[model samples]
Target: MRGEEMNFEPMMKMMSLSSIGLMIWIAAQTFTPPKEVVVYVEVPAPVVVTQVIHAPISTARPAPRPDSLCLALNIYHEARGEPLKGQVAVGQVTLNRAAVAYKGASSVCDTVFARKQFSWTHEDPRQPSGAELRPSLDLARKILAGRYIDRTHGALHYYNPHKVDAWWADSYAEVAVLGNHRFMR
Candidate 1:
């Protein structure tokens, strides 16, 4: 007995390590690296913005999306002769009015045709061609989709520089001048 190593703590520690090591070895032997497993992950479809812009716009407007028709009409009628940015600016103003229910208008159509707010609203309804409405329609969809940058910086009003200097123009802060129209907050 004296010839053998008699350190009790070291012997106990060795025994514990052997037991744990034996259990680990058994577990390691039982584990078969899982068979070639197959995993599937779902991916969403990509949105093509250009496809939406180039799509045909119909005057036979859908009921649920009348906002598009109303917004397009505003842009086409208000800034058809002006540049593209001017047209978008006009649409932005109409959107701003609709957002706050201005003049008790709860929708884009209501805002566009609000009393004498826009000159064309008081006049005869004009039928614009799809080609004429293409740009406006594209811009309108973009605006409603929350994708368009507010070129007017939240302007709710605008008037042509060459046209009448409205008596109330001095009442609000002017925001931007896109083309012919001066935008105001």
Candidate 2:
């Protein structure tokens, strides 16, 4: 018992790809925004990343495959406290941005993770994958499936009026006010 030493390095170094920190680093190094993105699933030993799939962005008015996990993450982080219609509005803005290559990003992931666009992206993304994530995912699918109404009124930009007076806000035309955000076109 006197010479017992617990090895903690293994616990400390689990998986690098599991964290959004690495993803942020990779995103920064990547200059060009892609039309699609590939996400990896971490498996047990000998199989670091098991599956690689293309993240659906946009195809038609109602996308053939409208559900993108990337889009869901944005809604979850940006409008977690917002109501159902509010969440859909936020999702619409993200889609609006991607449709027009806002901030030089074409894909949902790129637009969401764009430098300084969304505050949450710059911070730590713990990568929560559970029931708590369902609301956003469901909303993402619904909005993209052409089911939910466009509460944003085709607005391409939005911001919380109470939070900060964004300089750019003065320029865009404010279209809708839902929950805690002001949607602009």
> How many clashing pairs in candidate 1?
0
- Scored against the true structure, residue 35 in model 2 reaches a CA lDDT of 44
TM-score of model number 2: 0.60
Residue-level lDDT of model 2, residues 62-127, one tens digit each, is 432333677888898888888877888889888888888999998877888789888778889777
lDDT value for model 2: 0.71
RMSD of 1: 22.6
Q: What is the lDDT of residue 109 in candidate 2?
A: 75
RMSD of each: 22.6, 16.2
What TM-score does each of the candidates earn? 0.62, 0.60
lDDT of 1 by residue, 1-185 (tens): 21222223333333444563464345335433333211111222342321111112223335537899889888888888988788878888998999999999989999998999999988897788878777888888887888868889999999996978688999989989899999898
By summed lDDT, the worst window of 10 consecutive residues in model 1 runs over 49-58
